[model samples]
Target chain A: MSTADRKARDKENLKALILQGAKKLFLEKGIEQTTIRNIADEIDYSVGTVYVYFKDKNAILHDIHTIGFQELGGSFTELFTIEDPMDRLRKMGIFYMKFAIENSEMYDLMFNVKAPMEFIEHSEKEEWNEGVGTFNALKNTVAQCMEKGHFKGHSLEPLSFMIWGVVHGMCCLEIRQRTKGVKFSKPETILMDGYHEFLKIIEKL
Target chain B: MSTADRKARDKENLKALILQGAKKLFLEKGIEQTTIRNIADEIDYSVGTVYVYFKDKNAILHDIHTIGFQELGGSFTELFTIEDPMDRLRKMGIFYMKFAIENSEMYDLMFNVKAPMEFIEHSEKEEWNEGVGTFNALKNTVAQCMEKGHFKGHSLEPLSFMIWGVVHGMCCLEIRQRTKGVKFSKPETILMDGYHEFLKIIEKL
Candidate 1:
């Protein structure tokens, strides 16, 4: 390989390593506590070298967001492989909730807090889109499910938005440590039941 | 009334007024910008009076939370007069959204950020039982509906939590201002569609 190609690969690897270290620190210590110096230290690199890749602290956070979204888009990719359109739609919702429950901070990055608009506004850079935004994937599934004669009562976009609303809302409450008062044995079970509720309505449609 | 009773009532009213002013200002300028001194200035009271009632900035936040929980709980009092369980559940969810929509700041206070968990752990506070906490009234309605042979399968708490998940998930995404890339014509319509899906499982149950 050419020297330039090797250097590019090396830079990419370092970026990923930095992101990995940053995500860990941010989740454990919170965004305020995770410093560039700390991330550089974690990766056994100098702070100046870290600055070479990222312009500033927010830039680091933006990269962390990009890394998170790329992985998240991959997570929702499971919906594309399933054949039964109806089942795919159901699984998509389940996967969405499952993703939120598993990688909470990442989920927060994707949908909970504001994403600096640059990331959401198309200036997000190529690495951020993965296979298009996960929202599009979710929308396509909903549209396909609608075409197959499931969920006829609502328009595609709104329907998908509502589905996300319920899922995110429940998970947000659970994550916020407020669910203790709600008296649920498990939050997932509720999600499943709610999913079934939606399934029932769609079948009727 | 007696002079002592009048003084006590005036003190309570002034404290409430200060709290309301603080909440309004905090949302306008953020938690950091809204200060005790500023709050007192808004109400034309001395900073000393503000400190007499509140130990610190966090105390004012605590009182605002107390008031917010009461307002959130009170939203249901008008609905309980309706006897139809299914409609009540539907309205409860809709009202949940409306509450979040109308009282944006209070909604932020209730679930978006962490509050001082002073009154929630102990049951002595008013609105602690029945329908005070956001989960209580919703769960109570859900339990009643389940008992009436309306919806089946899942337990009420999890179902309630799931319902909340989707509702808040949608709201959170929108309210947090990160839906720039997300394409949805009618955001609420997309979100509430989860309810129909929810009812499907309920019917089978």
Candidate 2:
């Protein structure tokens, strides 16, 4: 490769390294407790090097959050091959739930954490394209289900939002430790069990 | 009143005053930003006096969360009088959504915030009686619905939890500003509109 091309690639690789370190610290110590210095130490880079890639913690949080959406999208890539919208919708929820459960810290950062949204507020482009894109995936699937004559009496947007709420709610409760405190009969399996109940209801719908 | 009785009443009133002030600061400046000193200043009490009432911020958070449950129960009182379990369950969700949206801060403390749960972990009892009581209310209503031949093939606990998740997910998303970030067609009414979709699905079930 040419020297200029190699330099550009090196810069991109360094930026990715900083983001990876930031994500690790966010998971281990929590987003609120993790700082730029922590990220710098995690990657064996100077604090100045970390700052060269991102303006501040919020900028790092925003980038990590964006990466989370990309990872989630990558996970959903296989579902696109399914022909039936109804079948795809059911599996979409399962994928969403599994992703949330397995990568909870990242999921929390993507959906629940305020820093990324706060970052968006201060940035010139205020739209949350990551969230909008994810929501639209669900909305589009629901729209297809409607075309196939499911969701008979439901409005599209509200119905899609309701479905999103169901899965997000289950995942949020589990991740936040609310499920364990409630002492469900099947504490370990309540997230999936509750989700199955939703699947049953939606199948009939 | 006798001197002893007057002293006891005054103490209770002062404790309530402190909690009210803390909640106000929690709402205005956020829970993390509001210190014990802020609470004391808000109520015109000394920091030591506030300490005399509660050990730390967690203690205050735990107590406020208990009060939030009580307020929720108070809001639920009228629903209990409905003869039909299905009707009562429908209205119960409505009441829950209303309480969550109207008192977003308190609702976050009751369900989402980690401080109260952390306090419970360190306390002697370690049982979340408040969460248990609230869940039992929903469980009993769902039990009634099952007895009436509604929810014919669903397990009681998971189904109840799913119902809880539905409302909670919508409220959490809205409270955490996820709803607005997604750019919903009707951001203002999405919570209720999403809830209405849930009501429709359960009605069929």
Judged by DockQ, which candidate is best?
Answer: 2
lDDT of 1 by residue, B1-205 (tens): 6999999998899888988889889778866567778999888999999888776675677677667778877887889998987778778777777777677676766676654443454335433232235676777888888888865555566566666666677657656664434544554454455555545444445
Candidate 1 ranges with C-alpha deviation above 4 Å? A1-18, A40-56, A118-132, A185-205, B1-18, B32-59, B117-132, B147-149, B152-154, B186-205
Taking the tens digit of each residue's C-alpha lDDT, what string does model 2 give over B1-205?
6999999999999999999999889889888789999999998889999999898889999999999999999999999899999999999999999999889989999998888898988889668999999989999999999999999899999999999989999999998888889888788888899999888889877
The numbered model that scores best in TM-score is: 2
How close to the true structure is residue A36 of candidate 1, measured as C-alpha lDDT?
A: 83
- TM-scores for every predicted model: 0.77, 0.93
Please give the lDDT score at residue B134 for candidate 2: 90
Clashing pairs in 2: none
**Candidate 2: docking tier:** medium
- C-alpha lDDT of residue A171 in model 1: 69
**Candidate 1 at B143: error in angstroms?**
3.6
